[model samples]
Target chain A: MVRYKAVIAYDGTHFNGFQKQPNGRTVQQEVEKTLQKMNNGEPVTIFGSGRTDAGVHALGQVIHFDYPQERPLERMRFALDTQTPEDIAVSSVEIAADDFHARYHVVEKTYHFKVQIEKPRSPFRRFYASYFPYPLDLNLIRQALPDLLGTHDFTSFCATGGAIEDKVRTIYQADLVVNEAGTELTFIFRGNGFLYKMIRILVGTLLKIGNGRIPADSIPEILAAKDRNLAGPTAHPEGLYLAEVKYK
Target chain B: MVRYKAVIAYDGTHFNGFQKQPNGRTVQQEVEKTLQKMNNGEPVTIFGSGRTDAGVHALGQVIHFDYPQERPLERMRFALDTQTPEDIAVSSVEIAADDFHARYHVVEKTYHFKVQIEKPRSPFRRFYASYFPYPLDLNLIRQALPDLLGTHDFTSFCATGGAIEDKVRTIYQADLVVNEAGTELTFIFRGNGFLYKMIRILVGTLLKIGNGRIPADSIPEILAAKDRNLAGPTAHPEGLYLAEVKYK
Candidate 1:
């Protein structure tokens, strides 16, 4: 058997998420189904770098699978792309080193949150952005961004009552890009792993700061408190996008 | 009575378009319903710049409505925004001069068409854009663009059996912007009016030219033929957006 790595992108609007579900359809199921159909219904399992919840999207998601037979990378890539649904595509395929594991070899990941604070909704960017009619203070959000970078115990940001006991993670960068079109907040985290709903919670906290509900400099205190209630509400999943995944 | 002009925007995915239908739900109907609810069930007829077809979105659509009593623009704007569904919003409201007509006073209209030619469907942009698998040659489309500009007969690009009899109109600009993200082609036409499906048909003709199925220079001949069959199929409405309306 040969191990192959595939770079993929998917629209999560019509999907239940990245993983396969017992009842509802999913991105992984769709990709696996396409591969199965190509191999005459031969069952194959794919491993992903991480799982995204429902309504979440991805631009550069990485995954790997084992095939009983060997084929050229270009042919496999084309076949997978042709067989996949319009919402999902296998962008690239390559033969992986025998021990390459999609999840275990991960070094970092980046996610983006798009917010449209205009009075009138954006016709073209409606689906891609979260609209907030309430006036947002961009300066406050920017002021609080630096507190999120670097290593920290992120227990305050994780969802309440998760199985995760260890919440330490390193954040390489937290960048905020505000333009006339909209506000795009990007987070680049280089960590061993992340807790459940961690990124969403972090976004919620920052949005609260923008909304003036929380003080701009209260992020460090909230983190130090290590209480989920100290953070802001969990943001909508539609605005969050898995932008990239890095592996060593 | 006090009259106010509103700049509106909506995502046409869940709406039936700009006009209010007898029984069907439309963006106009929804806004009107919200207005009536705000006014204790008092009905008000709202007039828009033009009728946008079902599934066609708008960014800068202008509308005018009359209120029985004096109302603050900020209050109405905020109330309408709060009451309207997430898909629609009233961006701005200004007390217009009594002579302001949403349709009659329009000097120019700008429309944008987005085609996602890249691999990877963006979940966030799925509802706002159309995906095309085949690669498009934008250079050829650009070469054919100049021929369509200026005042001339455009019967070949207008939908057959429409209400308009005059097909002659001036097209100020037909700009094509292609990048790594996707193809964003915008047409800024300065005309008195447009025929039904004229823009869609023009896009289809340009797409055909881009695909090499039609010669880039044959645009003038197609226009002079004054035949609907001379043009290609109408581009899908999902990719179309009314970007703005310029009023003098």
Candidate 2:
């Protein structure tokens, strides 16, 4: 068998999420179906970089699977495209080392969340951005990024309870950028790893800081508390995008 | 009664067209549905700048309609937003002079057609651009524009038969621009008027010229012949966009 790695981009508006479920279409399910068609009725299980919540998008998601036979990259891509729906586009495909794993070798990941502050927002962007009517103070949020940039227990930022007891994760960057139009604000996070809904919760907390619901200085206190209730509500899923996955 | 003019934008991927008909969901149908709801079930007809074909997007389509009452622009815009689908956006709305007519106004209109030469195209842009695999000679297209730009009897460029016998129109500009990545080519046409399928046919002919199917000098002679068969075929509608409509 030959192992292959692929970079995929998907419009997640209609998808339940990236993982397979008993009901509803998922990105993983679609890819598996394509693989099954190419593998003569044998369904090949594929491994993804990570899970993305429902309504989230991705531009450079990575995945891997083993195939029974080795083929040229172009022919494999053609077979994949012929079966995959238009909502999901496989951006790149290549053969991988037998030991290469899509999830284990990841050294960094980046997620971007877009907030649209424009009033009576464009309908065309309804599925891609979160609409927030109130004006936000950019400087306040900028001032708070340092507190969330280092390694810390992200329990307050993750969904309350899971089997995993450790909520510690290292964040290398927390950046906020406003597009040229000044109508949209993007929050970017790059980290070694992220917990369930962690980035969304951080975004929510930062939005509160920008709107004066909480001051920038309150971030350290929230981080110290390590309680989910201390942070703001999780931001909407539509605005989130898994931008990149890096591995050495 | 108050006359209002609005600038509209829509992703025409799911729309039948701009004109209202007995069947199918058209942009006119959706706008009229909103107006009907606002006007106490008294359906108000709107005059559009022109009809955009099915699967053709518009970023700055203009329309005018009469309403029973004069209210703040904000309220009207809000009401429209509440009823329109996510794929359509009423970007701007304001009161217009009673004498102003969207269709009869004398001004320029700009249409843009995008051709993507990139392989492994993104799924997010599935309906926004047409994918052309062949290498196009941009200089050849640029060399042919001077022959087609300016006042001319454009009978050969338009669809064969129409109600109006006068096929004369003046083109202010026929510009070809390539995106920074060089993967996409955009044909921009600004003119006082365009006949049915005129811009699409022009793009089709230009694509032929760029690909060596026809020589640059053939344009003037084709325009003079007044024969539709002599010109290139009409390009696909998906790549066409009603970029803007202007009136002073």
Native contacts recovered, each model:
0.50, 0.75
What is candidate 1's lDDT per residue for A1-248, written digit by digit as tens?
89999988887777898999897789999988988887788988899999998888888889999998889888999898778886786778999998999988998888877776665555445556666667678799889988888889999999977776778998887878776445444444444567788877888788889999999999999999999999998878877778888888
Give the TM-score of each candidate: 0.89, 0.94
In candidate 1, residue A50 scores what lDDT? 91
Candidate 2 stretches greater than 4 Å from native: none
**iRMSD values, candidates in order:** 3.1, 1.8
In terms of lDDT, the poorest run of 10 residues in model 1 chain A is: A181-190
- Give candidate 1 misplaced runs (Cα > 4 Å): A121-127, A131-140, A180-192, A210-218, B22-24, B97-100, B120-124, B132-137, B179-187
Each prediction's DockQ against the real complex: 0.45, 0.63
lDDT of 2 by residue, B1-248 (tens): 89999988898889999999887899999999889988999999999999998999998899999999999997888788668887777878999999999999949999999888776676766688877767688889999998878899999999876787899999999999998878788999999999999998999899889989989778999998999998988988988999899997
Q: Is the docking of candidate 2 incorrect, acceptable, medium or high quality?
A: medium
What's the TM-score of chain B for every model shown? 0.93, 0.96
